[model samples]
Target: MLSLTRLNRVRSMDAVNDTMIVEAGDTLLQAREQARAEGRVFPLQIGSQGSCQIGGNPSTNAGGTTVVRYGNMRDLVLGVEVVLPDGDVWDGLRALRKDNTGYDLKHLFIGGEGTLGIVTAAVLKLFPKPRSVTTAFLGFRSPDSALAFFTLLRQRVGQDVAAFELISSTALDLVLAHLATARSPLSLRAPWYVLVELASSRTPEDLENDFHEVMQEGLEDGSILDAAVAAAEAHAMAFWRIREEISDAQTRAGGSVRCDISVPLSKIPAFIEEACASVLKIAPDSRMVIYGHVGDGNVHFNPLRPVFESAADYLQRTSTAITTSVDAIAMAMNGSISAEHGVGVAKRDELLHVKSRVELEMAWRLKQAFDPKNLMNPGKFLPRLECVEALKS
Candidate 1:
């Protein structure tokens, strides 16, 4: 029932300190623009930046494309101002490089997903704006090959590599069919593709030389099957549209059993192969729509319903089993069941089966300590009955 949209404002902006105290309701796009206007950059580049609130972002610890270079929302935050459930405001919004006076309380709210309190405002870390940028759409034979090229590319470009995203042929086809402007960037029909972008404080010429050198090496080693380097800013944005519209495309293809998971960077190839196999074993004709931020080890491993399957029938027959199977595969590899996406209603109750007893207990204690009366976004990411009774007792 609470909305922060009207609270949107820039409380303060300290360019010299490379920090900004922004109200949580400010749209991410607005925050980014504010930083850019001041000759700095807010590097968290999620697809929903236009409307996604800055406060809600840290609630789930949203990680988008730039996570390869800038880390997640947790890393970008310096401090937060939270409203406790009992109606007291905790003003911990200190913008400093180091604060060792007490426990880092701001972190408790950053990824709390609204369970702890209301994040009304935050001090966000900003970086020096990139002086040069280049983007490329590349086709690869498989996930393994894409990873190999990614490794080689990183070796050459280092921190200049801002993003490395993996997209499947199936996922791209959905985007092309659903979105009018979406088009394939390369003629090659490889099973895997990567939308890689390089941004740096280095000069334009230096960055361009590195991009060309890495592309040549990838092509020579048979890692890059075909490539399309953006000739202009418009072309680059067009290429990015294909990645951004994937969720909409999935809905048009009929809904999918989505598994937002993450494994070790080295295990991405094997995880994809095993997870796809598991889905097929459950639903033989399900199309694997694999994609995600490869550099950060997160994968959006969704299985689209078979062409002939009814949406209702697909959910009835396979949704639970398919999600459980995919999650198990990720956990077996010492990975997480929830990556960028928070454990909302979809995976809330399922945490019991995956997390350890001690971990669950500690989480419960924190929830009880924060909101003992079970108010403030109750029944989220926790079992309803047990948590209520435990907090009261």
Candidate 2:
């Protein structure tokens, strides 16, 4: 965790906008709230907001729940300050949205995952905060139904649909069982559930009526079996907690095999079905807990526990097989092996195998130009020179 309690320095150009100089230690939430205090808001929001430093977020180019509206961290940044692997500082922190001067060098650092340079500070973009919001929890029979509802809701509601998160029954059960205060919204357990939120900068926009109407249509069309709309801010937070608590509950549950990948929205249903089928063949009694941001086509597809085997053994043995199985399907569908989480060291090889040759060359060139010695966050994201050299040999 990088230190973000107070930005090392901030140079203000205007009352609402300024160029902030932050160390690699600054937390994104601190940066966001600091900007908000001046009556401006940074559009980016991610889980681990408190602990995830701006440098880390920028390096990973992380996207959070609000990505459907605000996009990834790359979109919210204006400029960056980096220390080259050779120990030279590249101070390019500018508040201007467009400089058009030369190479947009910031891109090389933003999602580089710390491989090229050490991000010391950044000038970030800010926005007006929304005044009104709405939340809805809808239950579905399966991933197909959840996906169908997502399509219908998006078609009817458009960009106002800020979030469309899917939750599996097994995931919900873990939360309820492990989280002492957690409970299911509906009495019945459906195979899947969707937690949706709508927001706008303008207040008194009557989003609730629009939300209710779309959900009603969803219910009628069989896209949803039941729905629970949040009437107040407290209720909205309560509903959203279920989605937020998933990672924690999952950890408490047991050893897990996790993949964060995306396909086209239309292909999501088939992706889940085919992926689950493959898992079942390998681990017959494995509990498949698949859920995530359906609107963005990403899924936190995890397989945990089989009735017969120990959790430790299952994870150790199935790691390779699971990777091959998931990657094959994602590649076949013209989707990404990593949607938002990024490759880091975890998915580096998979990226090499799947990315195009031209794409790989361009990336490597950028890496060389930015940090020839490669002393930034070494052994992460892109492949090492030896790996590429070996490939050629």
Candidate 3:
């Protein structure tokens, strides 16, 4: 994961009525938390909340830490001020919900990953603070068990299941070994552990008890091997720290080619099985660390070199093969190669491999319409193509 970019001048508008304009340099966390301080909450957050800029979030259409309920950053944004490729401003900054006055031009730049323009400022939507919250840490005997547990919990909690993160034993081991204060939430070893959080809009509903009751049923049905519910606010923070630290722990372990992908919810169990098998078939000695937001059907499938192999050489040799195999499996299953992580430079070619020629042409036309000079964050999303006449010239 790319670390947060440092902001030179983070600024926010002091407007009233649940609306505010945040400068490009401001981090999503900074903007949202500041909005909350003014008695409103920005309904958007990304994984690198501490450093990831608002410009990047809206550019990549980041769906982060609370995507299950709040949706992506795209959903939270009302309007954006963008500088076009040729240095002209397109001021489409109206905070209206239903603006059919003309073509919806803002959609082009939202998920363009900055290829269309540089997002200068944005008017973000804010929601009322959640009344009550509950978070639980759960352990499962296997990946399938975790998937089953997700299904049961979603049915019970409905959309209140804000986040359901899966963590591997290898992943957890790194946290315990590398991070000094990290502690295991469960006493026994299991193939996978899940961190779940529930937030409610109402007061009378006890989401903690509701969550505990569901986990109890899961244990009785042999789905959950063990569980630990956060007793206090500090404990809830402790449980979340584990999930948040997984990426860092993984980095310290060894050389890894991390893939963030999504498949159908029903096929998650099968996708993991087949994808890992295919990887091992090619690179038999590779160590696989599988974990992700199972409830959202996204996985961070990371492959690391075995302890005996030279990490640099391992990555050099198997990098292409790993990507090819995994992407092929993703296509066969009607899944996505780049899920939450947008196709920056890493997977642009892979995207072309899966997308149709007509689809690519349509995208190119849209890009041309918005960014004629193509000077805005070039070489990020689609491959550049010259017009037939321009090529002749």
Candidate 4:
């Protein structure tokens, strides 16, 4: 594997264009720091930001917590310098906001999962750093109520709503049980929770006031069961920690089968209801640990093994059934099975089944055009035609 860690560097920061040129090997954390130093912000805020490289972000089209406001990696990236399969460098790094060129070739590699080419560097768009941020953790009676609260929040706050996440009660319970420092911000327990964050260039008082108003209204209207507003930055971080640490907590709790899926915003409640029911029908004793970026309609629907069952036994028995059932429901609801997570070896078969024949054909054609030898990141995202044929035989 070619290591680009040595290529890590922030080439330039042009405040006038609100753009920065960063080498692909630079970690997301480094990019964020450079942007901060330049009085700007790189809004791709993922849990693995500390170690995840910038090149991989666009290659996978990563959608982090701030995706609702800033969009995924494709939206944040303006241009990329890719090393083609032929060993030629394509330097298309232009920071212009408008380029009415013949074809926007940069997109061919962004979200391409490295099959098209190797991205060595990129021109990334930046935004003004939010001067103030307000966070609120609200307990809801159900996912329906949480959805209602989200709609109300967006209607009231509009673009100020930076992140709106959904958390299941079981997911929170696991966090509290596993993590030493984990604590529920709300006094009362409910079936579901929504972590609401508002960030803007406005004053702190303005942001806080908006949060209080919307949260109070949600509570009065019965959409919210109970709520906790962060009084300080520490408080906000604590609330976010519960959401961020769920995956780690799940690992500590037991064996987990995770589904990264997304449906229409209107279908979230129904999708969750049906998915949970389907999983329980297969594994009665399984614990459903569900949570995700609800604002962007992606949910990490994970099922944990029963306390009595061993990890190996549980995975062997329930893994395929659980994933298939959830993925089927998501497809029936016109949602995607892969969502933000890229289709690696694990999801290759699932991708083939879920994606249309036309879509798959086009993807294969593009892959052949870019890397005819199939030498670039082979057997990663798209399955090889020969492998599929061999499996059939």
Which residues of candidate 4, in runs, are more than 4 Å off? 386-393
By lDDT, the best candidate is 1
lDDT by residue (tens digit), candidate 2, 1-393: 334445444544344464455556667787777877877777676668888887777888988887877778888778888878777888887878779999999998888887887777877776666667888888888888777777766777688778888888888887888888887888666888989888765554577667787778878877678878777888888887888888887787776788888999889989989998998887777888877887888888988876577778988988678878987898799888888888888898776689765677778887788777765666778776566656654
Cα-based RMSD of candidate 4: 1.7
List TM-scores for all candidates, in order: 0.97, 0.92, 0.91, 0.97
Better of 1 and 3 by TM-score: 1
Candidate 3: residue 223 lDDT (0-100): 76
Task: Assess candidate 2 and give its TM-score to the true structure.
Answer: 0.92
Off by over 4 Å in 1: 385-393
Model 4: worst 10 consecutive residues (lDDT sum): 384-393
Q: Looking at candidate 3, what is the lDDT of residue 52?
A: 80
- In model 2, where do residues sit more than 4 Å from their true spots? 1-23, 202-205, 390-393
lDDT of 1 by residue, 1-393 (tens): 889998899999999999999998999999999999999999999888999999998888999998999999999999999999999999989998898998999999988989889999999999998899999999998999999888988898898889999999999998988898777998879888999999988898999998898899889988889999998999999989999999878987875998899999999999999998888999999988989999999999999998898978997899999998989999999999999998877788778778765677778899989999979788787765464345444
Residues 208-285, candidate 3: write the lDDT tens digits: 677778888889987788888787899989988888887887778767878888888788888888889988987898
lDDT of each: 0.91, 0.78, 0.78, 0.90
